[model samples]
Target chain A: MEQISPFKRLIASSLGKKYLMALTGFVLVGFVIAHMLGNIQIFLGPEAINTYASKLQNLPIAIKWGFRLFLLTAVAIHVWTAVLLTIENKQARPNNYADEKTVQASYASRTMPITGLIVLCFIIFHILHYTAQVIFDYKDLHYDLNGEHMHDVYSMMVLGFSHWWVSIFYIIAMGLLCMHLSHGISSMFQSMGWSNEKWRGVLKITAILIGAVLFIGFSSIPVAIMMGMIKPIIGH
Target chain B: MRLKLKVWRQKDQLDSGRLVDYQMDNISEDSSFLEMLDLLNESLVEKGDEPIAFDHDCREGICGMCSLTINGIPHGPEKLTTACQLHMRSFKNGETITIEPFRSKPFKITKDLIVDRSAFDKIIEAGGFISVRTGSAPDGNAIPISKSDSDYAMDAAACIGCAACVAACKNSSAMLFTSAKISQLNSLPQGKPEKDRRLLSMVSEMDRSGFGNCTNYGECHAVCPKGISVDFIANLNRDYAKASVKNLLKTIG
Candidate 1:
């Protein structure tokens, strides 16, 4: 028999793929929480957010790129394994029951792939809109915070979300993301075998709570901006 | 009671089956689901028509031979009951019951409502056992197993391999069954010797059997006749991970 690489052998099995999905999902969930925390600094006013954004930008290139690469790899593995599992899952049931019914699976659990795909699309659009600065150019939105020149992410967010359509789209995406997390968070624990009957109930509630918190925390910015509560910086 | 049953009728493995409706009258609510099917089969036989083909043995429900998807549920609407144990009283008098075979890529319908579940047997063959010496049984108290371990193992041992989990899963995954089998042995003292080998081999065979990956849907447990919890699956995942990593390290070091 041919000797297979351990990593290849791991990826080739159904259980192995699940482990990968769970681990990568864990990374992505952490990233989402951290990302939300950073973005919510906008609630602290313009200077606070501008300084925060500049500090992130001023990170050593190696550290910045290393984090980006790590996150990108995590997302890539998460999505790649998910697609594989979805395809296999589809093939597993070649025929459907005429009167199929869901028993105990939640709506969020059943629609994981759909929600995940939409979230992936949202991530791409978000990167292009903000990180890549290609969708709506915020390159000139510079701020002078205490005479320190920095990218005025605060005005850019306010201006970007000022568009009703953009805010609406962002809100919708955030809602779907929360829905995805509601199931994914709890599911990752199960996949990792860290969950059992004793902790299942608590884990489920925690998952929902985390999802709710993220939805509110992330969506509040767009909602506040759209409501004219968090106006753009004066003389921007 | 009178009822309408839309039972899947497949001639053979190659046949494209369909739900053929039959109106049944004079069915006793006391009869089990299998007995009701037997009544239907008797009528069909009397009419010189081919009776429905299904698998059943030990109608008391321990045999795990009965495999029918009653009204979209694997066993039936009743929780933790096998098809052979489900009484007709569970259904409404005028209800239309749609019965189908337990469907999955590995489970091929050989005929009406009878699928070939040998894939499960293959998984068991791969490693679902301990290599104990065959002789007069050892003393029951010899191992001194802990109460919690014995209870947990007993819970896993209750699985009868009915394939209801596969039928109920949206992905048609057999993780529940495989995990239960793994947990049953892996938790015991006798089975610990080959734990890693058993986990690796059984999971490999399961993957090779074309079952879908588990996404933690919990549908399997919902329909499991034995009420096997998905916790065994989590245990299986945990064990498999440890085994795989240990195997990798052995190869590298």
Candidate 2:
């Protein structure tokens, strides 16, 4: 491989880290917003949510695979970039706050990696349950809506919540995600330079709103299912 | 009231330093932080001791020359105000304030609480100007900048390059400072012609200056005397991206 030039070095630098963070962050934000919009369909009663799920499955095979591939790449790059940047930051400050100083950064900044790792595990587990059928094979995970079998994505979602232990863990994971994205999104805009006094107030409010909405929206589905508000598909 | 100060002391850039605790009694509550330090220096001078050295000018915070990290915070606790504006009333009658210089590779300390921020000057020289003829000044309304843009331009222009951002950053990144300067120019119509070149040059200079990369930490904004937002950093990136594409097209054309 040719030597990486100084120009390349600058682009790969700590400042360069912002480029990757901003790009992937924007991508994931797009995915989350879209995911939530779709998720809220569940609130429209079974017909809409299940039909939407079925429609998702009925997408052309090539398009379906394309979406999957794109999402996978985004997830990999997002997590990978974060892990590498966090390590670089850690190595830069080998020891810190000498003389027993109690001064500290916010919990989110300090534990970005840990929260990211937890969210990673949750993502893997989440995919296996919904995207992959084997893990939640025990949950009778299929339902037909609008004359199509969407791998019973809706039922799987509902059933995943019906299990008290699984839902509890999911609640914990989403809570961590809320903490991560809350700071992550606002920080992303700041790094990119869209931040100003007037907009700073708006961005902050938007960050908090996104975090609270996602936390409640994601957490409630499972909690509501576990509380018997939605029934598990027994079979057929 | 009397207070204890454990301040970082070093004779020069090459010297290793440590915090040395000094006690002073009956320090007036109304005394400015620097004034309190002056009292310590006065006592030391009278006792035939080496006076502690630091930096200050304008003593009003506008010049961004008074750089000090007090109690692990850049310019002490007040928001949107510099060390000069920070008065002694903010502190308790009996308190310990630890002071240090801004730590970053680009900012070499000449003495206690004073680091050379000439790297910022270098970056500014690299791109922070709009070329114009010296013969005559342009009419004020000729540019016609949108109100929103002008307002934000003022916000970005508010940055004083105090190095507080680097001090507060976990990575000691100067992105906030560089971006604010870039945005201040890049936002206005007058500054638009050089937008691409300015961003590319300044960002490149910032990296060349041995500053760490910004990790999107908001500490810099938190401690900034003028409250410059990180969004200017975003506009910087956008401009740079646009500039890169523009540069490429210009090269081809």
Candidate 3:
């Protein structure tokens, strides 16, 4: 019998595909935490966050673009593998069960794909709204404060959240991202082959807590802004 | 009681099956689901027509030979009950029950409601057993396994190899079935020597069999006649990962 390559075997197997998703998902998850922390700098007032944003912009091109490229590749592989697995799963059952019923899977687990797709859409919309500055004006990038012109990221964030619609969109997307994380976090361990009966409960609880923290941490910025807790920097 | 059955009929594995409507009258409420089918077959035989063909060996339900999808459920509507144990009384007098064979690429239809599940046997043959000496009977208590481990093993051992999990799964994945077998042997002391080998080979065969990947959908446990939990799946996955890592290290070292 002809032997198949181990490398081919790993990615071709169901477990292999799951491992890819779990690994990539963890990377994205770490990115989200870092992003939340960075975004929260706005709460420290204008000079603190603007300085921070400028520092990021001042980083060497290799470091900055390399990280962005890595993230983009991870996202691409994650989404592509997911689509392939879903197609294969669908083909497995040519005919749907007549009297379908859900017994044990949570709503979050079942809706992973839907929630994931929504998160993807939100990511693109977010880039357009803030990074590309194509959706709506948050603040003038060339605005001069203290006789020095730089991107007014703090004013941009405040202006973006000041609009009820944008804040609502961010809040809703973050909520779905929480749901996605809750299911993905626990499942990631399972795919990595570390889960067992004893750890199942602990893992599930931890996943929920992580989801809750992320939702609160990310959503707080918009909520605080909408409620007039954080105002645009005057005279900037 | 009278009941309407939308029974699936197919000539062979390659043929597309259709749900043929049949009316069954005077079915006793006490009759088991398979027994009701027997009654319907008797009527069809009397009329010189082809009887609905299905697989059932032990009407008592332990054999797992009986397989049917009654009203979109793998083992009828009852939870934790096989078709052979499901009584006609569970359904209303005039209810319509849709009966179909377990549909999955791995499980192909041989006839009316019977599907070829030998793919499961192939998977078992891959590495579902521990090597033992062919000698006089050994003392059962000699191994001295922990009570908790023994019980956990038994929970997995209870699986009867029915494909109900596959039928119920939206993806028709056999993660539950495959995992049960893995966990059953993985928990026992005697099977420890071959644990890594067993997991890798069995999973490889499973992937080759064209079964779908599990998305952690709990439908498999919900429709399981033996009520196997999805926890074993997590254990199996964990073991598989460890085995792969061990195997890779062996190559590098």
- Candidate 2 has a DockQ of 0.24
> How does model 3 fare in lDDT?
0.87
Ranking of candidates on DockQ, top first: 1, 3, 2
Pick out the ten consecutive residues of candidate 1 chain A with the lowest summed lDDT: A1-10
Model 1, residue pairs in steric clash: none
* DockQ, every prediction: 0.88, 0.24, 0.60
- Model 1 is docked with a DockQ of 0.88
A63-176, model 2: which lDDT tens digit per residue?
999998987898887788787776665544343433322233567765677998999898898888777766768345555655655455566677667778888889899899
User: Local distance difference test, per candidate?
Assistant: 0.93, 0.78, 0.87
Q: Which numbered prediction scores highest in lDDT against the true structure?
A: 1
The order of the candidates by lDDT, greatest first, is: 1, 3, 2
The second chain of candidate 3 has a TM-score of 0.98
Sort the candidates on TM-score, descending order. Answer: 1, 3, 2
Specify the highest-DockQ model's number: 1
What is the two-chain DockQ of model 3?
0.60
Q: Residue B42 in candidate 3 has what lDDT? A: 93
lDDT of 2 by residue, B135-188 (tens): 777788986889999998898888888888887788777888998998888888
Write one digit per residue (lDDT tens) for candidate 3, span B51-167.
Answer: 999999878878988889887778888998999999989999999889989889988899989999998998899999999988998998988999999999999999999899988
lDDT of 1 by residue, A47-109 (tens): 888898999999999999999999999999999999999999999999999999999899999
> Mind giving the per-residue lDDT tens digits that candidate 3 earns over A106-199?
8898888889899999999999999887889655554455886678888888888888988988999999999998988988887776776688
What TM-score between 0 and 1 does chain B of candidate 1 receive? 0.98
